[model samples]
Target: MKALILAGGKGTRLWPLSRELMPKQFVRFIDGESLFQKTVKRALLFSRPEELFVVTNRDYRFRVLDDLRELDVEVPTGNVLLEPVGRNTLPAIFWGMKTIQEMFGDSVVAVLPSDHLIDANEDYLTAFKRAERLAKNYLVAFGIKPTRPHTGYGYIKPGEAIEGGYRVEEFREKPDIETAKRYVEANYLWNSGMFALDTELFIDEVKRHAPEVYAAFENASTVGEAYVEVPDVSIDYGLMEKTEEAAVVPLNVYWNDLGSFDAIYDALEKDGNGNAIKVRGKNAYHLGIRSRDNLIMTERLTATVGVEDLIIIDTGDALLIARRGEGQRVREVYRQLKERNDERVLVHRTAYRPWGSYTVLEENDRYKIKRLTVLPGKKLSLQMHYHRSEHWVVVRGTARVAVGDREILLRPGESTFIPAGVRHRLENPGRIVLEVIETQIGEYLGEDDIVRFEDDFGREGDG
Candidate 1:
């Protein structure tokens, strides 16, 4: 079966760590592997590298490529579908199914979300096999047997027993605590958001129940054109709930979407006092006294006293502290920040680019300091800032610099200055990664004050 990994969600509930440019799927949270990487590894269990596909936002193209490179997995580049805009799960799935049909013709495609944490053990393999069997006759959704009353996940009620699974009787929305308890009592399964779909069956179902969506993609010349007309509807809403072909295969495995801080807390290892502490960076550590049942994640030294059932997340640029049960509401903070056009809503102090990454060291109204790390053989765009002048001090490796007509090479401790409106480019010509300290002085230091003359990444506008 071919695999279609969805890596497009923003994961706003995990804000302060998960941002627009770097969503939770791309963030390394477990054992040096991003969730996306783990999902890729999981996909490989059922598919070869050549058969694997990914659907993600256009903004995440480089990140997806980087992750694949890290895994040493060579999926066909064209197989990576970049969505022009998010039109929810149905459109993304349809695009993947259509592509799979066009290439492999009526194959079984496993649809998996990249941000989920799943134990890809024997059970997982067996469950997918079961789902794939069901997919021949039904649009199969792998349903996790509910371990507890979880109000955060949608519930699926299974109907008459089929060959390897049961027909999906009803699809229920996320419920209140009392309703969730009732669901658990009734043996409702948590919607796993994973599917094993027969390309032809899925297409037929969409054509029958969601004709608008089917027409949008079938009639369009490009994915972008189709997206322009497709409504933002999920597969569950647009197809599964309305289709007679829906089937649910029970998947008994350790699965967690990590949708909220509370979920993260539950997934983490805890101390004797029930405190889950995760510290990033060498010098970062957490000390807690009377801090039972608290989830504390930090990048620097953090000490807590007399705290219980609290979620504390510190990512250098922002900190989130909330009561454990209120984790679902964290997205409200993200929405509020977005409403105010706060940069924190979009990125951390360190921002990633196609070329490399840069971390803000200091910034004020008139000046900004950044530590830029450019990978070997990589270069920034050939561009100039209209509002800011830049001073670059090389701290490591060698930098081939271009300041208008003057081309120069800078080694460790060497520096260069580019006046405002003067074109300049920084390239790492050495084998080692290049690190540079950049100081910008100007009246306006917004990232949008740039014009790209040449770019290797096909990027045209603001970074």
Candidate 2:
């Protein structure tokens, strides 16, 4: 069986931590493993590394690579499909299935989301087995039987038993609390965003029901053209709701989409005060006094006093405080920031790149200070900034610096200056990581001032 992972969603509801450049799937909230890494690990449990496929956007390609490397799991890079434009689940899944058909020919493929929190217990394996058996004749969807009234997730009603699962009777949107209470009482399952598909059957159904989506993938020679022509529709809206072959297998294992902070709170381990503290213990400490039932996540020493049932997310740049069950509305705040062109919406204090990452220590109108880390054997693009000049001081390891035409090897405490418009490159030539303190001074110190003459990651003109 081949595994297809959908990793393209920019988790906006998880703002302040999850950004446009770095989404929630790649953000490691706990366990030193991001949701994407966990998903990959789960995928590996059933399928080999070569048979695993990831569908993500063009922007997140490097982040995907970095995380996979961090886990020490190497997969064929070509299996990581890059969606030039996101048209939602329909296209992403369709593209992945089509590729699987070409490579392996009519295999049973399990579709999973890269950003969900799930318990990989015995029930999880049992559900997958049930779905696989059902997928031979039907497009099977794994559903979580709701334990409580949850207004956050869509509901699915199961009908007659078929194979190891049941036919999907009805699908419902996110309902109000009263409606959710009714759904919970009626034994409706939460629509876990995971599906098992027989590649050929799914393609045939897509062609019959979502012809527009099918035609785009079928006719295009490149993914770029396919995305532009494809309709921005979801698999549920395009095929599952319209097809007669829908089925849902009950996955009784614990599952949470982690779509909002409230869900995150529910999924995390809580303290004696019923507070969900994400940062506590060895690496960091979170002390709560008189705080009850609050969901809090922070890096530095964070303490809450007399706050109850509140979602308090504190990042270096932004802080969010809201009542419980109000976490879904974080998207509204993100919308406002995007409309106003707020830079905070796209990045945090630290930004990751293909080489490594850089943290902005300080910034002002005339100057900016950054701490850059270069992985061993990795190098920055051979480029120059037109509007800013840079001074780099090597703090650790060795650096092979190229400024204009001259090149030199610099050790710790050694510094170099590059005037504006001078082509320069920084490289870690040693076996250890290269750490450097960079100071920039100019009229315009924006990241876009870079003009890359050479880049290894094809990110010459990125922000």
Q: Give the candidate number with the greatest TM-score.
A: 1
What local lDDT does model 1 show for residue 399? Answer: 98
**Per-residue lDDT for 229-313 in model 1, tens only?**
9999999999999999899999889999999999999899999999988899899999987779999989999999998899899
User: What ranges in model 1 sit over 4 Å off?
Assistant: 461-463
lDDT of 1: 0.93
Model 2 deviation from the true structure expressed as Cα RMSD, one decimal place: 1.5
Off by over 4 Å in 2: 280-284, 461-463
List the pairs of residues colliding in candidate 1: none
Q: Summarize candidate 2's per-residue lDDT along 359-390 as a digit string, tens digits.
A: 89899999999999999999999998888999
Candidate 2: TM-score? 0.97
